[model samples]
Target: MENQVAAASGKLGVLVPGMGAVATTFIAGVEATKKGLAKPIGALTQMSNIRLGKRTENRYPKIKDFVPLASLEQIVFGGWDVYNENVYQAATNAKVLQQTQLDAIKAELEAITPMPAVFDREYVKNLDGQHIKAKDTKWNWALALMEDIKNFKEKNNCERLVMVWCASTEKYIETTDIHETIEAFEAAMQADDDRIAPSMIYAYAAIKMGVPFANGAPNLSCDIPALVDLAKELGVAIAGKDFKTGQTLMKTIVAPGLAARALGVNGWFSSNILGNRDGLVLDDPDNFKTKEVSKLSVLEEIFQPEDNPDLYGELYHKVRINYYPPHGDNKESWDNIDIFGWMGYPMQIKINFLCRDSILAAPIVLDLALFMDLAQRANMSGIQEWLSFYFKSPQTAEGLKPEHDIFKQLIKLQNTLRHMMGEDLITHLGLDYYQDLVESL
Candidate 1:
């Protein structure tokens, strides 16, 4: 397909729906990175290298150098929040960074304030935000969000904009008749249907405005058929259901390693305790259900019991998230994985990871925003399956099962980038290189 969108240049505004911990950390990290305060360590597009062609070719280039992505300096950050705090205050409240680190970018951080959020008390029962839209109907609230987007774009002088949902997960909502079609969804919004969550309103506004949208939380933001169809129709890139960070990130990494070794996992019990606003929100079972679905899917897709029944068919995977106020945003996860080896000898691998929730999520937010913008510029619409590497439960095209194996997901992501820039997809088939030598001899 011929590329139709203009080349990505000038400033790209990253409009976040939630400007709490992850959002602030992301913006601060970018500012810190720009001022040489910190390096973008986990960002693949910024730090990782891609191997092109045969191993003998010795062609390894940084991924950014290969693709036409927006520079970190060129990325402008703005977003909505339930709290009216600026990025600096939000960062301080989050307590994810050291005082000295925050002080370094104090001025830049203080200047960015969150626009009033379009939030509802029902979806996230644990959170009560005084800073929210007061509109009566969902459609009116959505139009207000569109106005925010336009004003943000004009004020920031951005050539393009992308919205990433870094808000807390909403209550678990199954796809309903309201979510079945664009027309039904529009009518539902107009009628203020009780089933429709606040996040969907934000998503509707973004997709209608032709802005690329990515969901960082596990909320059903852009995942519904209505939004998916709208995205494709509008030709804007969309990705996610959740950000793949912390425990799930580790799960994708370790589960693949276990599968590669053909180890039999009898049970995997994972639990985490965090005290961030996200944790506070998820403390409610309804909200946690949303996160649970996104968290639990990795093992089923990764192990693929149909193919490796003996190794994975009996696997019992359980995930739990607790709200422990003492820990705050520093999420500590304990995973006890029960496995059996060659002779079916039972063994266990226990991991206790003490990770900062927002710190880990910050870079992911940056990568998604940049990559989603790149995907839009490259004219790749619909569900951005290539960016699946960054998501927890990647939204894919209907009828296609998502590839959950991290290595395969990585290859798909990298290959998509290569394909976009007219480069050959690396398949690890080096027969051609050896064939040349054999013929020459």
Candidate 2:
């Protein structure tokens, strides 16, 4: 494919739709990273290495060094929130970062006050805030979001901008007739159709404005056919459904490892406790369903029971999330995995991971924002399936099954970057190198 967008230079504005815990942690983390206070640890684009040749060649380079990603210093952060607090206050409320960390970047964090949110109580029933847009119709709300994007770009002198949803997951909305086509969606927006959720409006505004949109929450967002068509029409790259973090992250990592070994999993039970706005919002059954779908699909796709019936046909996977106030953004997950191996002997693996939800999510937000911006600059548009490593239920081009294996997803992601820069892909066929070694031996 011929490249269309220009190379990434100058400032890149990352406009988030929600300035809650995940969003604030992202902003703070970026600021800290720029100041050398913290490394972009979890961000694969920033911190990981890629092998560019056969294993024996030893030609591994940092992925960022290989690809032309936006530098941490050149990223500008802005967003909207249902609460009026700035990044500093939001981070404080999130309690994900320490007072010392917030104090260190106080000036930068406090300056990033959220623009009023385009919120709907109907979509997210658990959240209530006075800082939401008063305009009732979804169309007006969408227009306001577009204006916010334009103003943020102009104000920050950004050469490019991308919007990522870091907000609470809305109630589940299946693909209805209204979401079937861009025409019907736009008409629904005009008629103030009740079926159109708040996230879809933000997505429409982003795609209409030629900004790459990524959905971090599992709400319908840009996944529907209508938005997908609009994104392609506008020639913008879009990705997501949910950020793959915490327990789901573990499940994806472990499930594949087990499946690779041809182990039979009889049952897998996952339960988590978290105390954040996301947690509270997910306390509602409707919102949890949105999250549940995103979380549950990983095992099914990874195991591929149809292909490996003996190993995975009887797998029972259950996920539960509890709102425990004491945890407060610190999500703790316990997984009980029952497996049999080597003559059908049953074994169990119990993993208890105490993780910070927003902290885990924050770097993913950074990586997605920066990479999506890079994809735009590299002229790659429409459904960034290569970014599936960072998401739970990754959005893909129509008729394509989402790949769920973390390692394969990583290879796809890295290979896409290498391909973008005209580098050779590593296929792990190192016969020549090993052959020479054997002859010498």
Candidate 3:
């Protein structure tokens, strides 16, 4: 069934929470793409292709062409940051992109500056920035953020806006009674209960303002019951928990292959070292626990030890992160996998990956913004499990399992797009064509 989707018109305001390495890199990359200085390499909205109809039809189209997504030229960038630097300055400090490329779009980046951010050091102990909103009750903080969103939309002449959390990871916190319902959550916010987090305030502000919210960190932003109910009630689309990049990205890609081959994984040890702000925040044990949980859960879901006990029942998983200032935004990871094959034959796979953190994450931020915007325009509300392809720990409905296999996630995403556009969903049943040919005889 084809659903009517609004045409992509006017400027889409892409508002990010933290204008740090990932956010700045994304903004700069978009500016560079507009100027023909660089390409949007990893963003599926810009670069990936979708297949429609039968294989014999040979119909393939770029995702941007198939779906009604905001064009790169039609996007406006603005966000909040604890640091008062403009996008250009923030990009330079990040060192993710070279100086020469930044020079080309320096003026455009400089034109965009971060507004005061709603920050609290208690949540992210490692970061304390001077450019923060006035210390106030949580309700007031949400209101202030909503005001910022309004002013930004009017000032920039944006037709629509979406918020993506590109900030540091907050310390781990479980859902409590305050997160059970909207009334309780708002009451806690008004009471300034410590249970509410700054990210939740941002989420509440965006959803209340009718702007779609996507979380790029492993924090409990819009994943709780209160916000899920709020999004559905307000008819806003929301997705995420963390952007899948670097080590976790590799894990999702590789683990599925092992499972498909029926390889028994006995143990998997994953370690990463990066000097970026993310690494620093994760250096704190509480914050690292949040990230650890996100990274570790990928395997269990993909392997399904409960279903395949002989193959994965004894699986042991360990994840570690180290903060090494010398590496800056360059993140290096090592994975040691212990697997057994037929007759319990033991084997091992070792992989050492040296990757740029923001470089890998920049496109994810861009894609989530555009896709989330499309979801909103299409009237798809609540948890967007179809956009799970870009997240590490995708937020799902209550008691639903998240699809961790990257290939499966991609199929779900593509099928959703097909379903949205009134096209036949491909099920890879090519034998049907042969059966028809034989029946004609």
Candidate 1 residue lDDT tens string, 273-387: 9998989998999989999998988999999988999999899999999999999989999999999999999999999999988888888888898898988888888899988
Report the CA-based lDDT of candidate 3 relative to the real structure: 0.94
Query: TM-score for all predictions?
Result: 0.97, 0.97, 0.99
**Runs off by more than 4 Å, candidate 3:** 1-3
Tens digits of per-residue lDDT for model 2 on 1-441? 325436678898898988988998889988988888988789887888988766657888988887778888888888888899999998998898999999999999999898988888888999998898987678888888888888898999999889999988999879999999998998899899989998899899999999999999998888999999888888899999799999989988998899888899989999999988988999999999999999999999999988988888999999999999888988999999999999999999999999999889988998899889988887778999999999999888888899989889988987887687767776766687778989998
Clash pairs, candidate 3, are: none
* CA lDDT of each prediction against the hidden true structure: 0.90, 0.89, 0.94
Tens-digit per-residue lDDT, 1-441, candidate 3 = 355788889999999999999999999999999989899999999999999999888899999999999999999999999999999999999888999999999999999999999988989999989999999999999999999999999999999999999998998999999999999999999999998989999999999999999999989999999999999999999999899999999999999999999999999999999998988899899899999999999999999999999999999999999999999999999999999998999999999999999999999999999999999999999999999999999999999999999999999999999999999888887999999999999
> By lDDT, is 1 or 3 better?
3
Best by TM-score: 3
Q: Which residue pairs does candidate 2 place in steric collision? A: none
Residue 384, candidate 2: Cα error in Å is 0.4
